[model samples]
Target: MNTKNEGVISEIERYAIKDGPGIRTVVFLKGCPLKCRWCANPETQKSIYQLMYWPNRCIACKQCILECPNNALSWGNPGIQICRADCASCGACTQICNSQALTMAGQHKTADEIMQIILKDLPYYQTSGGGVTFSGGEAASQGEFLCKLAKECKKHRISTCIETCGYAKWEIFCELLPYIDYFFYDLKIIDEKDHMTYTGVSNKLILDNFSRLIQAKADVTVRIPVIPGINNTQKNVEQTIRFLLEQAPGCPVSLLPYHRLGASKYDKLDMEYTLAELAPPSEKEMFQLKEQFVSFGFPVRIGE
Candidate 1:
């Protein structure tokens, strides 16, 4: 049997609404291959710890620059200049920053350490019918660790679930399916070219995996993040509904409207915001998508 020290996790959030049934303890694993233009969790994109700075928190103290051991932090006319290439994310600057302007993204914790934190909320899980949900940066990307953690959760009679992009190997997904009671699967653009254009990867693997999950009869809830001017069109919604109907006929789908919630994070990471001008879909647009899915006789909800 594999030990619990194998898997590395970043954060464990309890009482999450959008992950699964009732309340949930969402385990956020770091690392992702896709670079979606409007990703809400940009920090999870990288596999290692990264420095993040908030301009609003800076009091012009310049303490971070002096404390930075790698000389990566420098004061500029505008604010501070952090050399990404030179900075190793040692968190020395983050620790000394009295204004809390600088912060670090990832931290390492074993599966046992994670499970201990999760079990603390067992009472809430029991009353709410919620369980542990392993989310990503693509949980299947770290399949070996996830599989072991799922088994451990099962041994303790704790319900388990996984929220995935479905861009993973079939064998790895299959191994974890039995351990997962419910799957919050994401279905973005149906067109291969459009999918690759927006999310940096082809939808072939995702579609194939969805089909496999249906064949294996896994309990799944398909989630669609409805972004305006991107996938909020009638054509896209129709195509998505058709695909879901043919693949997982009666499975419920949730339409998640896009928001500018992650826009601030892009600035903190010093990354350009591609969808800065793009606004979220209107309530009418979201209702239109819901109506289209309802016409197909499939159970649908507006949000989590």
Candidate 2:
């Protein structure tokens, strides 16, 4: 497959309302540059295919162990065991698993293949004033494929939104500018050190890109994941408010209270969730945060 024409993705969700202006289709492209500690979509973090196993779904059929070409599966005390090192994520075992215990997270698809799915939702998009949203682990991480898909969407007069972390090159953002109608950009932490500690990357590039977007008059909604014990502190919020006040005054802000919805996914993928004990911010907390933004003359909304 031509790399520029193909993209690895987790799923194509139809009828998504919160992601964009109206009822929409959300294309979850796989791959990311930053490893945000509080990322809700762990499966999309890696570009390659990942094997997911559910113990409850396993019937002890041992079908997977027998099907493994890499000898990566075996029986353990409670259930089947996977040697991730040996496993190539070829998905042979998942294909043969009758009990639906095993599955692969990533799918390699051509832009045309994805456009077919998007076109199917045309009636809904037209009536609801919704369009396709290119979301991801980070849509910009798959630059070429994302540009191709967004270009195709525009050709069909489909309004497009990109939900991004703002960590990619400015050139990629430039490529996407003409095709994207709106951008849901994340502004997780204001302090550069804190940002690095939590998201495994410096915020310099992110902030720089955001500033450029603001200067360019791009329609962007800044999203902050209100994770407890992270960026929820008064000091951090103040810094965030100040930065936005300086660079992106009046830009709409979306306060997304952090949730543990994807925590269980860690276990399925055999990955550790460091914030397992952390709880989501309360309604009162969200309101207070919203008030901070609103008080500064910035439009704010909680949740999506």
Candidate 3:
């Protein structure tokens, strides 16, 4: 088992739907290894904590530039350039900026400290059959912290779930399986080469760990993000159906059509939105995909 202590989480989102079986408190951990082009939560991409700056919100008063000790903040026509690599997340610029443009992404908290916040919604959990879900920026990237938190949730008799890309080692998944009641595993593309082309890593480890989970009879749900012109083709869908039938016939599949909801977040993070012009799949396209999955006798959900 990997015993390294990763950084603690940044935020806990309570009463979340579409994450698991019931109403869930999603603990948003702050690190990931992959540089997925369509990543919704771009702020969580980095391994370390970061502060996001909104260019529109800035009044161009140069308050932030003056306050930054490292000279990381500079004013250009594009607004402020807070050098992410050089600037420490000291919040000095964020404090001086009155427009609420500069904001931090992560916070350090102990497992017990987080649990206290989670348990407050225990009544909702009991009523709605929801407990807690550890989501990312790939939760498995912070395996030790996730494992410890999962154990604590189980000790409280809270049904637990994890939304992961399954990109970590099998040992990491093995250590986590005991505490997780449901696994929301993302299977974006079946073809390893295609997967790597978009998600910046091979799907070999993901596929291997998923097969291991199936052998262990873990409760798993497969998710596919139906990005138009990407994985939404008939061939990709057929390949996915074939893989699922052979590997995990019992697992329910959800087809999540891509959206531009996170496009603005890219601006806030000062990162490029690669699929800026790409529109989400049409309703007709979504239903077509759903029908394809249904043809294989696989239960399908259109979104989430």
> How much is the lDDT of residue 239 in candidate 3?
87
Model 3 clash pairs are none
Query: Model 3 over residues 47-78: C-alpha lDDT tens digits?
Result: 67788888878788998888999899887768
In the order shown, the candidates' Cα RMSDs to the true structure are: 1.5, 1.5, 1.6
Q: What TM-score, to 2 decimals, does candidate 3 have?
A: 0.95
Residue 293 of model 3, lDDT score = 78
Displacement of residue 22 (Cα, Å) in model 1 is: 2.0
Query: What is the per-residue lDDT of model 2 for residues 274-293, given as tens digits with 9 covering 90 to 100?
Result: 99899899899899889988
* Each prediction's TM-score versus the true structure: 0.96, 0.98, 0.95
Pick by lDDT: which candidate is best? 2
Worst 10 residues of 2 by lDDT: 1-10
lDDT for each residue of candidate 1 in 72-95, tens digit (9 for 90 to 100): 988885688889999988999989
Count: clashes, candidate 1:
0
**Candidate that would win on TM-score:** 2
